[model samples]
Target chain A: MPPRKPASKDPEPLPRSARKDLTRAKLLQAALTLMGEGRSFTSLGLREIAREAGLVPNAFYRHFRNTDELGLVLVEDVGITLRRLLREARKMDVAPRDMLRRSVSVYLEYVKLNRLQFLFISSERSGGSRILRLAIRNDVTHFTNEMAQDFRIRGLYAQLPTASLQMVCGMIVMTMLAAATDVLDLPPDQPLLEAEMSENFVQQLKIILFGATRLNDALTRS
Target chain B: MPPRKPASKDPEPLPRSARKDLTRAKLLQAALTLMGEGRSFTSLGLREIAREAGLVPNAFYRHFRNTDELGLVLVEDVGITLRRLLREARKMDVAPRDMLRRSVSVYLEYVKLNRLQFLFISSERSGGSRILRLAIRNDVTHFTNEMAQDFRIRGLYAQLPTASLQMVCGMIVMTMLAAATDVLDLPPDQPLLEAEMSENFVQQLKIILFGATRLNDALTRS
Candidate 1:
């Protein structure tokens, strides 16, 4: 008997594009898990990552050209994710003091939710990979620029020069990154230590914001 | 003729202890050079470091049990070097504004002189190795405590609470470290970029100090 052709009405259960996306995501997840385990990306092997994702070594090439390419993608993804979250946090209408506290709280909460991504960015910010380091720095520069714009819109530090505003924004980014590093480094068993770290981070931001306000006032008077 | 034993009046050309000390110093120097070249200590191999130092792999054991131990020694040496330089900077009797500028100048000079050591500390501060990260943090904490003590002696920040004093000192240290990282990461031929970073650092510190003085005044009035 002759074989009958399938009708066009029947749809494919899982399309090729979707399956490829799943595999790519799995590879990224594997990398994030390994980094979350305290291993830097430079120390990770392509084969190890592929194996963790349950694929053959050659399958990695289908997703990424190499580990550095994968790392760049990861850095970009984390940067976008963080900026989106922070932007959302800034949308809240609150007093300046409350806004500062709320922004920090939102940031810390994001770090908690995306522990591996935060850890990867913080660790690789000064890690061995120059490309990854540059990517993180670029993202940080973008973040600072956005922050400076926000400050300008709010008329905060309006009297300061553009360079000074960038400096203040840069300080805020660095301090937040440092706090995230400290939080991620804490052992999981030490809840008290984590709480203290969170509180201290808030207090540190308060001090910095206070100083920034005073500087703005002085510059205006001068 | 049989080799004659050294006479009581004859001194050894290179004493065993002195030779051992030189070998140890060579190892540390080799590691610093590697780190300055953008290779993190955690990514470095023991054999490679020994080879760079012109010593056999086994010879490394005499100086350190492992790379982590060598890293610990490096951290300690950098900490001591920085503390000594900062202490010298603090000894200058000048007005508070001039003092801030001078201290920053002195610190930047030290960074210029010891670029490798500073790079090592900054890179490893948030690097992969937990032990190295902890060692750097401990040194930073020690530096902050010493700064707080000096502040107490000079009646600086006298109106602030002890925790607030430490917070200010911690912010200063973190800011300096961030600036150091920027300077180290700059291209060697970019002197203009380096100068701008240095100028920006000084200005940033001035803003912080100005804010700190205001805080002190407000607390005093309250």
Candidate 2:
């Protein structure tokens, strides 16, 4: 007898604030997917992105001023995500080699999860929106500084100077992005087997880290 | 004027074929410049590139279909240059350590000299141009094969398989790009001033080779 009642006429729409955040997040996610597919932000229009997010073109402005602003926000988010991954890895009690391996696993995992944001930052280093480029530099600077502190605390870098550590961090970031983009296979978006690539990635990273460490030791002895 | 030239007039423009090649080269050069400045080809218009090359818009299509075609040509040029650089370096009589050091020097020197071309290829990875992306991959494959041959001849890599050597080559490519990006801010690009960074690069390459060699040796002993 209770089944006779009709469904409610309408469900409530998202609250204005919630809807705004949702729209922004949707746009960013869409951007990440598009960018991951090797599409550059320059070739991407706001309307195209808005359509991808299933929102009207004008509604895009409700979340941000324009695509560039949206990209900057995405870059910052990527930076934060990258930093958090490093921080979490630092807390684990794994062997240094395993820690790096896990770090790379997390890195590849993050890229898979946030492909667009990573692609945006990666592409910007070469062909990104102006705001995205600036954001990348700013974020990488902050990231390098963070690593410098970690290196100092670990005393693994006692012989090397602070700037040296920054250089290593920068090298690592560049290599990471280069490796990620290479494996992603640019436009047409081939799905790389992350598990296999991550294994190779760890080996490469270890080679870099081990080599850096030994070189520092050799110089100290000399 | 000594008996002034009779019927003085401007020389006819370059021959049609000559003009076409000149235009193609100019377009490629302009693409490199813009790409080197971190501009994406997709975002850049044919007119702007034509302007950069000191040509009118219609003159652009005379050379190529679009900027994507121009980009692929530039990628091929880059690969050829790199191949030549390595081939020349391979002919020098130097110790393995010195050879690697010199190879790195050559690489960095090339980047400095051909900054635009190098930057363009690195940044154009994510451009939605199929042919251009394939060109990049072709170059990478060619470079890897060349490096593999070098390792085979050196005997240092005799114990490692061809695939492993290719992996090392990939690492080398990745590291060289990272170094050129100056993302690390490691001194100036001056090879002499960059002794530390350059040394670091060589040391890392050495470690990868040496480490693999040692690992293989240990396995044999076991």
> Individual DockQ of the candidates?
0.56, 0.36
Error of 2 at B72 (Å): 1.3
Q: Compose the digit string of candidate 1's lDDT tens values, residues B1-222.
A: 434864665565688899899889999999888887768888888998999999999999998999999999999998898788768867785566566666777787788788888888887888768898899899989998898888898899899888878888888889999888887777776878877888888877766676677778889999
Query: Candidate 2: lDDT of B94?
Result: 55
- What is candidate 1's TM-score against the reference? 0.91
lDDT at residue B86 of model 1 (Cα atoms) = 65
Instruction: Output DockQ, candidate 1.
Output: 0.56
For model 2, residues B107-171, the per-residue Cα lDDT tens digits are 77777777666666665655446677678868877887887788788775566667666777787
How much lDDT does each candidate structure score? 0.84, 0.71
lDDT of 1: 0.84
Q: iRMS for model 1?
A: 1.8
Candidate 2 structure quality by residue, lDDT tens digits, A1-222: 345544464354568888678778899888776765656776778998999899899988888898888877887787888788777757774466557776777677677676666666666765556566667878877887887788788777578777666766666666687667755553334445555566667766665676567657876997
**RMSD to true structure for each model, in Å:** 3.9, 4.7
